[model samples]
Target: MCAEALALLRQQEPWFVSLAILGALYVAAVAYRLLHTSGLALCLRGPKDLRRRYGAWAVVTGPTSGIGRSMALELARRGLNLVLVGRDPGALQDIAGTASDTHGVLTKTVQFDFSLVSTPQGEEAMGRLRQAVERLEVGVLVNNAGVATPHATYLHEADAEAWVRMIRVNLWAVTEVTAAVLPGMVERGRGAVVNIGSGAAEALPSYPLYSVYAATKRYVSQFSRSLCVEYRGKGIDVQCQAPLYVDTKMVTNMVTRGGLLSRLIMPTSDAYAGAAARWIGHRRPVCMPNLGHRLQWCLCHFVPDRALAAHRLRENLRQRAVFQLLRSSSGEGIGGRR
Candidate 1:
C-alpha cells in the first residue's frame, strides 16, 4: 500500500512540488512566529543599550501593581532609573523599593490619581509629575494605568461614574502624561513611549457588553499609531501593546486562576512584562506580544462581527452565572458584573 501511494504521488509531480512548497512555507512561518513570541530574538541579540538609545530615566505610571509593576522592574533590571507614578504613595514606594530603590539614582515616586485628571487636585498632581520628570533625561514613558467595569455588565447597567473613570485612566491620562513627557524628548531628540492597550478593542471585531472599555482601548491603539507617525521623524518610538487575558487582578472574571487552560493562554503579569519589555524599542507601532494572543488575533479577523459579539455576550452571561453561584456560596468573594 505504501509503495502504491508513493508511485501515485510521484506521477503528479507538479502538484506534489507545489503542495510540498506550501507546507514548507507554512512550517517556516509558524517557526518564525514561535521564535518571535518567545522573545528568543531579543535574547540572541542581547539587551539594547537602552541608556544610549533612549535615555537614563524611564517614567512608568501605575507602577504599583499588575503589568505596570512588572514593567518597572524589567526596565530597572535593564539599567534605566525609574520614576514610579501611581495613586498610593505607600504602594509606589513599595514597588520602587522592590526595584532596588536604595541604590543610587535607581527610583523616584510620584503620587497622582489619574482618575482625578482635570480637577484642581489633579492639576496639582500633574504639576508635581512634571517637576519630577522634566528636568531628568526621561527616555521612556509607560502609560500602563487603566480600569474596567468591575465585571461583565451592560453599558446601561454600568455605573456612569465607571465610564468616566475608564475614560480618564485609559485615554485622558495617557494623553496628558505623553504631553508632559514628549517635549523634553523632542528637545533631546529621542525617546520611547509605551501605552498598554487591551485586546478587547484591537483583536475583536465587536465587543458589545463592555462597550466603554473597548472604546477607550480603541483610542489607545489609534493614538499610538498616529503619535508614532507624528514623531517618527523626531527619533521617538511610540508603541501601543495590546495584550489579551493577562492573568492580572483585572481579568479575574475572564480567567480561572491556575486552571490548565488559563495557565496556557493567560500570561501572568510578570511573564507578560518580560516578553513585552523586549519589544519596547521595536519598530511595530501596535502589536500583541504573546504567541497565543497573536493566533487569537488572527482567528478573530476571520470571524464575523455579529458572531463574535454574540459569542462575547454568551461568555459574559456565563461568567455572570459563575459569579452568582460563587457569591451565594462564598458571601461576595466572587467577581461579578458591576
Candidate 2:
C-alpha cells in the first residue's frame, strides 16, 4: 500500500509543478500590464488633435459642489472657459467668481433646479441653460447633475414620487441636456460629453436604498457607451465616469449613520474629480476611479449571484458594526437609536 501511494504521488508531482509555473506566469503578466497601463498613460496617448479641437468653452452642470464643482475647477485650470449650472443662484455665482478669479478664465452662471424640470418651471430653467450655451462657443458638455433619495427597505415601501424624481434628475436631465448640445457638436465634427455615473451601475447590493438611483446610473453608462459607438466616427466622444461613494454632502448624509461597508468603500470627491479629468482629457469610454473599485466591479461581473449576495450581506453587517462603534465612542447608543 505504501509503495502504491508513493507511485501515485510521483505521477501527480509533475502535473502540480507545471500548474504552479503556469499560474506564476499569468500573475506576472497581469502585474506587468497593470504597472504599465495606468490612467496617466492612457491620457498621454490620446489624440493630440482632441486638445486643439475642443477649444476653450465648456458647459458643466451641477457645478456648485462635489465632483461637478471639482471638474469645473480642473477644466478651468486647464484654461477652459465655463458655463456653470446649478440650482442656487448665489452658490453658482460664488463658484463662477472663484473660477474666474483663480483660473483667470471667463465664467457664466446658469441657475436652474434640475429636480423641477419636468414641469413648465423646469422647461423654463432648461431654456435658460440653452440660451446661455448658445451665446458661449461651448465645445465640451459635462452632464453631471444628479440626486438620490434616502435608502428604503424595498421598492414598494419607498416613496414612488421621490424615485421618479431621481430617475428624472439622474437620467432624463442628461438626455435632454445632451440632446440640446449634440447637433452643434456633431456638425462641428469635434466635441466631448462626459457623463457622471455611480459605481452602483455595476449592481452592487449594499445600498438597497439606492436601487432606483443605481438603475438610472446604469442607463447613463449604457447610453454613454451606445452614444460613443454612434458618434465615434463623427469625431464626438461620449464618456462615462462611474465613481464610488464620493466625499460630498450627499454621501456624508447617507453614511452619517450608515454601515461599515460604506466606510470601506467611500472615496473623496477630489479623487473622483482628478480621475474624471484624466478620463475627459483622454476621451476614455469608461473610467472607474480606484483600483479597489475596479476590482470589485470586475468581480461582480464574474461571481455567482448567491455568493455575491452572501458577501454583500456580510459586508453590510460589518459596516453597520463600524458605524455603531463610532456612534458609541461619541457617547451615542447602538443602531443610533439613542
Candidate 3:
C-alpha cells in the first residue's frame, strides 16, 4: 500500500504543484481585496470627510429610536446638521433637542408618519418636509424608517390592513422618501442615500414566516443596486446596509425568546449605526456591516434553501409563541415595535 501510494504521488506531482500555485493566487487575491476595502474605510471615516463629500446637512427618516436614532447621533457627531423625521411629534422634538445639544449641531424635526404617506394627512407632512429641506445643502439622506410585522405571522394569518401598513412602511415609504430626496441630491451634484435593510433578505436563503418583510427588504436591496448604477455618474452614492438582528425595540421580544445564540449574534443598535455610518459613502451597493452577519451570508451559499427555511420557521414559531404569551399575560404592549 505504501509503495502504491508513493507511485501515485510521484505521478501526480505536477498537478499538486499547479494546485498549490492556484491556492496561493487565490489567497493573494483575497488579501489584496480585504486590504483595498480597509483602505477605503479608513479614507472615508466620517466626521469632516463625510461632511465635505455629502454637504453639512442630512435628513434622516425615523430618527426617534433604535438604529435610526443611533445613525442620526453618529452623523451629528461627524459634524453634519440634521433634519429628523418621525411619526411621534414629542419624540421627534426630544431627539432634535438632544442631537443639537449633545453633538453641537443644528437640527430640524419633521413630524410625519411614513405609514400615512398615501393619505391627506401625509400631504400636509410632505409639504412640511419639502419646505424644511428645499433651501438647505442636504448632503446625506438616511432612509432608515421601517417596520416589521407585529409578530412572526404567516401571510395567510396576517390581516389585509396589517399587510398594507407593513407595505407602506417597509416598501412605499422607502420609495417615496427617496423620490422626495433624490432630486435634491441630483441638483447638489453630490450626496448619499443610506437605506437600512435586513439579513432576512440578504443573509438568508429563505425567510419562512417573515416572508413579506423579507420580500420588502429584498426590493430595497435591488432598488439600491439599480439606483447606484443610475446615479453613480450623477455623484449620488446609494447603499443598502443589511444587518441581522440588532438590539432594538423591534426585536426585543423575539430576541429575548430566541435564546443565547440569537442574543450573541445581535449587534447593539449603536454599534451597527457606527458601522453603517462609516460605510455609507463607500461604493458597496449592498452590504452587511456586522461581521457576524457577513459570515452568515457566506455560509448561506453552502446551505440548502429548504433546510434554512425550516430552521427559520422554528425560530419564528418560538418568537410567535413568546409574543402571544406575553400579550396574553399583560393584555398590554410588550417590548417590541408593532
Clashing pairs in 1: none
Candidate 3 stretches with Cα past 4 Å from truth are 1-20, 33-48, 256-264, 333-338
Tens-place lDDT per residue, model 3, 230-274, is 999999999998888888888876665356666447878888787
What lDDT tens digits, residue by residue, belong to model 1 across residues 1-338? 99996777778879777898699899999999877755567678776777779999999998887888888888888888999999989998898888885444588899999989988989999999999987899999999998875455677776688789778888999999999999999999999999999888888877766778889999999999999999999999999999998877777756567776665578788888878877888888898877667778878879888898889889878876766676688886432111
In candidate 3, how many Å is residue 11 off? Answer: 17
Worst 10 residues of 3 by lDDT: 38-47
Q: After superposition, how far is residue 171 of candidate 3 from its true place, in Å?
A: 0.8
Tell me the whole-model lDDT of each prediction, alpha carbons only. 0.84, 0.73, 0.83
What TM-score would you give candidate 2 relative to the actual structure? Answer: 0.76
Clashes of 2: 6
Error of 2 at 155 (Å): 1.6
CA RMSD (A), model 3: 5.3
Better candidate number, 1 or 2, judged by lDDT: 1
